[model samples]
Target chain A: MVSLQAAVESAAPVSRLHERASFDPADFPVPGGREEEWRFTPLRRLRRLHADGPLDAGKAGVEADAGPEITVVAAEHGDPRLGTAFVPADRVSARAFASFREATIVTIPGGVAAERPVVIRVRGEDAGQAAAGHVLVEAGANSSAVVVLEHAGSATYADNVEFLVGDGARLDVVSVQDWARDAVHLSHHHAVLGKDATFTHMAVTLGGDLVRLAPSVRYAGPGGNAELRGIYFADSGQHLEHRLFVDHARPDCRSRVTYKGALRGDGAHTVWIGDVVIRPEATGTDTYEANRNLVLTDGARADSVPNLEILTGEVVRAGHASASGRLEDEHLFYLTARGIPVEEARRLIIRGFFAELIGQIAADQVRAKVTAAIEAELDAMARAEGGAR
Target chain B: MSTLEIRGLHVSVAAQAGESREILRGVDLTVTAGQTHAIMGPNGSGKSTLAYSIAGHPKYRVTSGSVTLDGRDVLAMSVDERARAGLFLAMQYPVEVPGVTVSNFLRTAVTAVRGEAPKLREFVREMNGAMAALSIDPSFAQRNLNEGFSGGEKKRHEILQLQMLNPKIAILDETDSGLDIDALKVVSAGINAYRQSPDHGVLLITHYTRILRYVRPDFVHVFVGGRIVAEGGPELADELEASGYERFLAMEGAPA
Candidate 1:
């Protein structure tokens, strides 16, 4: 007997009342790399994803499984919540939204607390191929759950993810972009929070030739809170970018964003852009954002920009900070003065710089994996320098 | 018996990118083992520069000087090399090292100096004893190294390190600048305890003679315009406190 889930996923498109997102791929114009959002990105290296390139069906595959209380369904076009939070904000995301065949919807019933996290694994098995994907996550009122979107393997992929958090619910979404060395990834994630909801979104970007992720948030009612935290490391010839936006539309809402990155080796680059908008009606809103980057080697580059737009002065607190610098001379001096060698001192400082954020990962295995990845990046740079010498 | 001998020492510091200014001029001093020397001077007289130059601080450049520790060229050593070569400097403004606990820093320093990691039990026992002797609270072991420590606490921590590392020569740069009487007595006791070693030497650089009353240097040198203008015994320190640097400043036609 064929499984019920497989039949549903392969069935004809589901009928709904909402208008379908244009799948023409030509609906979005090609970005010229001169736009403010695209200025720091290298458009010529995108492998033609910006110019209506075909998304190979077998390039990247998705396999999602979840706890017993959550229902997983294959949603077709015209599903209202499919594109509700996740509107294609850019050309690549628009192309991804337009070309995807079916979207996956994962729903958690009201007040049902899952004992384990919902794990969605997306693995790329082919090189020089591009694929598009979409996932919609909904948590009903008073429920609490964690959804982990784990990406690994090869292929150039573009995808859009959405989160609809219900009132009084708590939801944590961790999206890890751990692609292969030759792969390229561009993803957009949007979360719409309900009244009195608590939402947390974390992005851990470690691998990929060029990975650009944009995660945004919007609140439906007051008393909502959202936190966006991310960590990334770019090695030689790697480009990693994370751009986040938090829109405070409801009064008494709160939001926070913190992203830290380290770069080493020649042509290793990272970009973090945090934009927070507090509307005039968003009185009593409290928001803060901070971005810090540590450039380990000589040729690495990091660009951090934190923008805050407050339409009214009635907010509780709003502030933003961005800092990028190499290893501090004083810190090195302090360490070396005690007899630790220069290389060991640097390793210790970098470890300490990332310890705060790494400790925040609730998952033990992921935290260990991230720490190991950082160590590996450092060791790779050391090996490269040794080889050059 | 070893000695740290400095003769005709001259040093310059870069005021900016291109310009250099001389801070130490024609100073001569000898610190033999089992002796303590106090170099007292007014602000901006280059007392701290001498301490840093001997410690090989990158900010201070020795233009024409010879610093020899037991016939080894101290001037040719890097900061860490100088530290490993049995020379230590207790800075006035100890840098704050975040995310490094005091216990870890001390253990690492000791390991580096001894060229091997110490046994955990022995290291912990020694650390506890040193902390107790310096009157450091037990919680300080877990705190980040000098990150948020008070002035007195920093001085005590420095002495704690001096005791733990046990360098052949120790230079206390303005160690008594920001301390209460009780703290001064405690720190002085720690230094005196280290001075009990027959092969250890102490160099105290201070603006006030207040700490000298507790540590009691064997020799006192009055510094003016980056050089020692007057050298005498402990009586010189008493005279400087009683009469101030007016007589010495006027001896060189310098402003007091």
Candidate 2:
């Protein structure tokens, strides 16, 4: 095992967070290339960030806005936990603290359903360094709220968010990871669900030099449910990866995940990994995971892996499926025969693929905003690839 | 004169490089404006191939033939271009587009066919009237194109598109399949409404004669072994429905 100090020394970019004292990349064990979980992932992307510059918080203008009733928690020296437990003092604490140095947290009181969305806007300043943040959402019992985390910046940055859902509570978290063209983004979101609690998380990754997001959910109580949906599109030289893990710890819990991605242009690689685990005590647990990828160009690549681990013999249902391929020519011909231009037809097909995920949004305003953002991203990508030729 | 004329039409299916199998077999048919022609046929009679070939499906190769819509060379254009040239095919299996709403698709199709943007109010009114005439729910306008739709709903949507686009020539392939009597009545009523246009021509293809009773056709052609072996008035459909395609198959010496 490599020590935090030694790992930081080995990875140059890890030195930038040294000042914050909470986020030490070296603390987290690097998965060997042989690990089953990291088998398909290109770990080289992380190694590249090793030599990057320290994140300049001043240059990376990350802003947070909350409703009047909501409380804003800032990352100050005294507030060490950042609203959630800073686990494994050397591991996530350093990263949480480094993020806390400028991170903002929003809290919705018990039984309060906020009409306005809590928006966290992150803008990067430099292209070399990375910036991360910790989002701690504690929805009290029977409470419901919506949070929108928007990532838009000119520089490269790494973002981390951890959420906790209370018993019988509901939380809707929508994340827009739209960064600069030359920036690299690595985001990890871990969620813990309580009894009868509901958690809905959606991610739209449209912009980044290289982007990777891992969203994991653990149902700790019986009858808990989690819905995870994601949409990503990558064009020319862009890499977008999403990995999801659903852990069912108790009986009668349900988990559903569906992710769709579209890749275009040369060297565009998009990956999806879905893992579901049903513990011994989690009998009668119902879980389904599916990932679908569409390759829109000759050189674009998509990799999908769906894995399920069932330890309970009494499990009711556990299934996983993965598919990756080029767009169906017959479907294209069908659309074109209706007089739709090829470009517009592609847009329709792509939009249709992500529509089911977007429709799951509970808030109309947030749904519309997300839809518009997706459209803008698609248009920009289409124009960029169109102009390249 | 409004007419879709196929003169010595020769079509083939591309099997491999420079390898094509003749399918249409030099078939000839004329559908003048203001007339509905029912092409009744058994399986593999090139009925669908002819329809798809006419609609410019790239898979269907027309080795030697001329398909002219109102004297315009349709075979020379692309599928969508032919649609803009006033041709429409109500697909037998309507493709389901999960995210596109019926109204958006209809608006786009109507705009493309008309070569102009349709005013929202007028388009909505027109669509609403059509849906009402077909006894369709107004909420259907916001649903995704044929996504999660019932069999009858899909057929109704096809006719809805036809009523909205109002093309010069419409080819409906197996539009009567999977439809109940009430739905069949609604679909026939929609087609009947479009038949009032003197410039409109319809070629309805079906395996059954149930729909012809509702929307009477001027001419009926029995397609067997990739050729139209028999032709007559509306009574021919009743005759075929009674005796089945056995007589036609016997006449052509082909297995039924």
TM-score for each of the candidates = 0.90, 0.88
In model 2, the clashing pairs are A13-A50, A22-A94, A22-A95, A23-A94, A23-A95
- lDDT score, residue A234, model 1? 89
Decoy 1 TM-score against native: 0.90
For residues A1-389, what per-residue lDDT tens digits would candidate 1 score against the true structure?
Answer: 11224323432222211113344556556878786778988987778777767874646778788988899998886777678775565677778887777788999999999788888888999757778888999999999998889999997888889899999999988888888998888888989999999999889998999999989899999999999999998888899999988888789999999899989888999999888877667889999999999988888899998767666667888888899999898788767766666676777778777777877775566778888988887787678777888
Model 2: what is its DockQ? 0.52
The alpha-carbon deviation from the true structure for residue B245 of candidate 1, after best TM-score superposition, in angstroms, is 1.8
Q: Which stretches of candidate 2 lie over 4 Å from their true place?
A: A1-59, A76-103, A362-366, A381-389, B14-20, B250-256
lDDT of 2 by residue, B1-256 (tens): 5889998887889777988788887678999888999999998888999899999887888888799988889998887898888888988888788788888888877777788889999999999999888888999999988889999999998898888888888999999999999999999988988988888999999889999998899999999877788999998998998899988887564432
Q: Report the number of the highest-DockQ candidate.
A: 1
Model 1 residue runs over 4 Å out of place are A1-27, A64-81, A101-104, A112-117, B251-256
Model 2, span A141-224: residue lDDT tens: 777888888877765555557677888888888888788787677677778888899999888888887877878888768888
